[model samples]
Target: MNQKLLMAIYFYPRGGSSQVVRYLYQRLEKKWSSALYSGSLGNKGLLTNAETFYRPLNVKSLDYTTAHTAWQKGTNPFDTENPMQASLEDRINVPDTLMARLSPEQLAKQIQSWRHLFSKELLEPALAHLHHLTPMHNAVYELWKKTKIITHLHGTELKMIEYIRSNPKLPFGDWWIEKMIENANMSNLIITVSPHDRDLALELLSVPKHKVITIPNGVDIEIFKPTTLPDKVKMSYWKHWLVTDPQGWKPNHNPGTIRYTENDLKEFYNDDGSCAPILLFVGRFTTFKRINVLLDAYSIFKSHSKQNAPLIIWGGFPGEWEGEHPYEFARKRSIDGVFFSGWRGHDDLPLGLTSSNIFVAPSVREPFGQTYLEAMACALPVIATSTGGPASFINTEPGKKTGWLVNPDDPYSLANALQEAVEDQNLRETAGQNARDYIERMYSWDNIAEQFTSTYQYVLSHK
Candidate 1:
């Protein structure tokens, strides 16, 4: 048998791309033998992935020793044997006088700032810059000079933009593009998760088009399978009941509750024992996510339709961001159909997906949306914006296609799609089934992993 495909994924821990990185890790670990050789600011990426997936065996956090001078005196937080520690010690050699020149507090502050700055998102560009700026730090010039190890750049581009956006006068702006090119050359293979990103990487970084591969992100099909939901869930039906309440059901849902269990669900149903359809919005609660526009569209949709408004299962609760709550905004506007579900993880996400008639992704700038893929895999139809990464997958063929694509920023477009999806149950079910079939053929984790494995083999053989 061929040797195991030993690969290292260079990633940023808490950034937007971690979801995709974790998905890649989950898929690859199922088949080929793999380990996460992580470098981060505060080992944040490793910790974040750990919390999200919470799997520890495959992970190897490698914080650089020279990343902090204290490490030379033995106070580094990372494992001593980490690859980064070796590179750090070997590269950053301050003169004895120079080291003793600074006060302890000044030295500590400098190291602390450096430690905080190395996010996974920025690691690629920083590594790429270091490769050109100080050739001794280049992994390609050192470790890969003889070893047959394969290195892949996963979520670097997003961070480069962040660095550039935040620091215009960032060092090496003159050679930044060239350094990025060198880093791209260092990778045995580059697997970009979206078509738009693939194009952007090749164009901006000067990576050869043929060297980059675009693999649309995938979902865990087995885990996200549709469940047999009850015909009458005995939940409240206020918003959606106004339109299609043939059962003459009264509203039974209470918006103020910590958890809604089966007994509570039954008791919450109307006197006639029937409930209305629920709409769902799941993802991070942030401004770029466009939750405000969704509320506005929901208000408009409810006002126009004579049917009772649908109950919304909005996940992604906001932390103390000081921004006004979008649900509260909808409520103030007399939009009474939203039931916020806070944030649910892997196991509960599928059940939540199946519980809704439609999944709406209205992000104004979504880099890559794993939630859309998850929703589709759960046999739930989607109404996503026509821009961003989700645009690549949410094809708009109306009745036969997987789901509807709309202008995420436009209230009318979202309203139109929402109305279309809710008007006909057959349309919703058909799109939902098609979505499930599409996910199985294209976006299942097993298939994605196999594709990656093949890419690894090809890159190792050819490079």
Candidate 2:
């Protein structure tokens, strides 16, 4: 019989950690009897509802929809029956208020909610794999102290801590950071996505070197791999996503608040009437993502870009933003070629990557860029920065690279890279194929699942 295992995370299906849990559970389900405990944000039928996102898995969720709704109605989300979990970033207009901003009472509620989340499924599993260093970990320790736990840091927690270190007096950040360290110290093992992150975890969590492991995320190649859609089909998808069903939102507004006109589709073509090279960017509107810098670079590229070459910015979780909104930034600068796809489903991401000619997201120090790998799998040559997770993987070598690498946060460097990429179809096609090849050899989910199998085996055997 398969040994029982429990995996948990504090967030619902809103971010990378959620997908990591789902993908791992999908693969590990073959060898381990597993159940998921996640903090959820909506009713039963919605994607934020953990049961729905992790459907068919034995699931137990702490619904935050009521709490989130309360926040929407101008009440404190944290004071509701199920308080919204705090986030790594202190986002405005979102239920995930910054962790540092949480008051002492709110912090206790965060831990208690999570402590109670596993009230039933403290299912006596042989091992428990918990994602992040959230208050959830504190709760897990109290409830399942005997069950060996492996803590996985997806990078945001580290970022938040880094911010706290710089601003040590920032509210209750120091207290929370100490708890995160305590959680990390208690775990049997700590997992990070990139070598850089692995090293960072050691410094931030103050854990022994033996306790940390680096495991890059995996991609579902079957869904994300390169495809050649017919011309009409491509046009139909573009029109449908941009004109017919936009999800882009403005400050205080929800999805579909920034829909485009049907005439907007004309921007995808050159004056000569041929399809233009599409530059795609996908990520949330956080400061580190450098969407502002991308707009600056795209403006430089468009100044001389012969083809209309529209840059499609593909995600901005409605009403939630960390800095000058990318939309507002673009407006102030009078940049005309930028488009927003807003936030769409993960299944649609592959389609978006495949639809574009080149992919670029100049995130400074991404923990582990799963989207970059997914873009590579879709055969799109990417443009990444030399600073973070993508640096560890993307090769910009003359003959071997999957994509181009520009200096982080430098608009001129990115503009030059974008110009070179958009102008040469031959270069893009070659790099695209190389990207696909690299992902097949290095990032497939099956291959990654095997790594987890070995790691889990090691943890169990030592236990």
Output the number of the TM-score-best candidate. Answer: 2
Q: Score every model by TM-score.
A: 0.67, 0.96
Candidate 2 per-residue C-alpha lDDT over 1-463 given as tens digits, one digit per residue, 9 for 90 to 100: 2377888888878887788888888999888888778888777777778888888776788888888888889988899867888888876667778888888788778878877767676367777888888877777777765778888889999999999988877878788888788889999999999998998998988999999999889998998999987656777788888889988887777788777887888888767766788899988888889999999999998887766788999988767787799998998899998888899887788888878889999999999888899999999999989987899889944578688999998999999999999988899899999999988998899999999889888888885
In candidate 1, what are the lDDT values of residues 160-187, reduced to their tens digit?
5434545556444334445446656665
The 0-to-1 C-alpha lDDT of every candidate, in the order given, reads: 0.54, 0.85
Model 2 residue 103 lDDT? Answer: 85
The local distance difference test score of model 1 is 0.54
Off by over 4 Å in 1: 1-27, 37-52, 62-156, 159-182, 231-273, 309-335, 396-399
For model 2, state the Cα shift of residue 271 in Å: 4.2
